[model samples]
Target: MREVSDAMGRPWTETGRHWWVPAVRGACAILFGILAVVWPLITLLTLVVLFGAYAIVSGAMAVYGAFRGVHPRDSRTWLAVSGVLGIAAGLIAWIWPGITALALLVLIAAYAVVVGVAEIVAAFARRRAGDTEWSHLASGVLAVIFGVLLFAWPASGALALTWLIGLFAILYGASLLLLAHRMREAGRRGAAGTAAHAV
Candidate 1:
């Protein structure tokens, strides 16, 4: 919520704290959850196929990027590792398409657990730092619950992970889109207000 002064010495408030962004994100998340629940198998299969394609593309890109690096000595090791891991993942998925879905589910579950713990820790840190917003803490609690559920019954949770991941992606995308729209709107309103004040 920082305000910036224009060249004309007019102050413009930042619109980053607007509620519309979170609302839109939440709506998209709900929609994604619904879609996953409605078409679980299709979503799961599509995700596995998509991961394989991504891994191959990413591996090739990483290798190319590594070669094009200005400081080859400094970045070569990291890039090579990235390329190797990506290529290996792609090969594994290609060779065992059937196990890809299960593997993905396990990875997702592990990620959820790690992320949940991180969020919870962050919430506590923020609280200690005197941020009064309890919503962050609530979100952390929800994340932890989701992670536990994901790990508890992985076989049954595979479908659940699809729903959760889809929801998160949709929400994150919608948040970005909404924030961009809101910023544009705020700019227009600020311009109008300034013109009126000048008149």
Candidate 2:
């Protein structure tokens, strides 16, 4: 049946072509994390500016991946939506750098939850099709948890939030790196399969 054939084929694995997208994202995250760690005692305005820059970069990457990666329409939609939200958040933060710390946290938390849910959905879709991308799943879960923590404790202040963001970025970056590697492997396997079939 077509269902069985599709399941065996695992078309979702074609994301290997865009493996570099996640790698770039991971590198940016790591760079942001390092900067955050370096300036542990930054002012509220400074934190806002830094976070805004990060959000913009992350948004741009997500948008690029949405078009660059050969994902299903649903997956692409999620990525695009997440990217738009990230850009919106970044713009808001940049425009209102004087906003209170709690306000900024709420904005970040909301953005994370929406984006995290979309990623989780996309990740699970691959799993259902037997793609088994563990790094994707882990990163989605991490994003959701981080968002929840920010939502639950808005009073954590600038210092704690900075540290939290730093840690999250590092772990998230590492997960993306793993995902990129896995994607590359998937691409190689797909190529081999194609060559074997042709032979």
Candidate 3:
């Protein structure tokens, strides 16, 4: 019983089995973005609540993928760490909803940096494992850029920040959705090939 592999010699099952995780994360991000944009005048408390919900949902999905998705051990570790950070950021936002703008800025900045780095690491791990899609890498790069921008513009008004965050979320969510689609396609191809080989 020879194992069927992808073009890069990694098992196809590993790449195709968990397409929904990113899809869920992406949906959450896009929803959050829409809300942020639609309600640009949202208060600190509202921002906290909205962001908290998005982070927790996204993080939870990442954690689930870390445990359930087929991947290299290193990739799983990074993904798990990213998920935990996201959850922690959300919890912090909820627990301290009244935190000053500066505080929230710093917190969001830190979370973005940590998650971005983790994502980059995971992307490389997947690449090493023979996954050809660059969406994951692009996502990581985008995250890093977003984090840097947030940090560099810490004094930006809340309204500006709100718009920035919204734009970032939309872009990030779109990338994740693309990745998910590719993953699903890869899975389908793998399944078809496996069946044909068996026949």
Candidate 4:
């Protein structure tokens, strides 16, 4: 973990920038949301496939972001872990496309709980690292709450589950978008400050 954490990101890391990672995630989520809404008549099998793809893509993007940045310490490790869990969940759904809505909901709940906890821990870590420019805490809390709610009520019907999933994706996507904007703003400020000092 330490070695990986200390190692530099791939040569393409610089190209991602911090904001681009979350921006990609948010965009994917928004697209998924639009699809769900526009094609409400899609079959259950299609929904599962769409959701699996969304989870896998989201996880991949997260992993890329974690590894594609020059993060200090073990700060970004949780992000990577979250990404792994997401990928695992996605693969499970893909393999068992015939799974019931309740089962999918359970998987989603579990994923949310794990990822939410990671996000909260990462939030504190980022703050400790003097990167208190984002609102991850709120997002983390929301995720936890969403997970708990899903867990508490696993009997939700198929249509309801679909809507709930859609809502979560949209909200999560919006949050990431805001966080990315903050990251961009922070970079701009940092560059401006550096230029001022140079002048």
In candidate 4, list every pair of residues with a backbone clash: none
Q: Write model 1 residue lDDT over 4-113, tens digit each, in one string.
A: 44223434332222434334433544554456556667655666565455445545554554454311233344545555665666666567666655577665455445
lDDT of each: 0.49, 0.78, 0.82, 0.71
Best by lDDT: 3
Candidate number of the best TM-score: 3
Q: What is the TM-score of each candidate against the true structure?
A: 0.45, 0.87, 0.92, 0.84
Best-to-worst order by TM-score is: 3, 2, 4, 1
Please provide, for model 3 over 70-182, each residue's C-alpha lDDT reduced to its tens digit, 9 standing for 90 to 100.
45556888999999999999999999978877788778778778888888998887776656668888888888888898889958655569888888889999999998888
Clashes of 2: 0
Expressed as tens digits, the lDDT of each residue in 25-69 for candidate 4 is 788877777777677676777877887888899889878867766
Q: If both were scored by TM-score, which would come out higher, candidate 1 or candidate 3?
A: 3
Candidates in descending lDDT order: 3, 2, 4, 1
- Where in model 1 is the C-alpha error above 4 Å? 1-28, 48-99, 154-157, 160-199
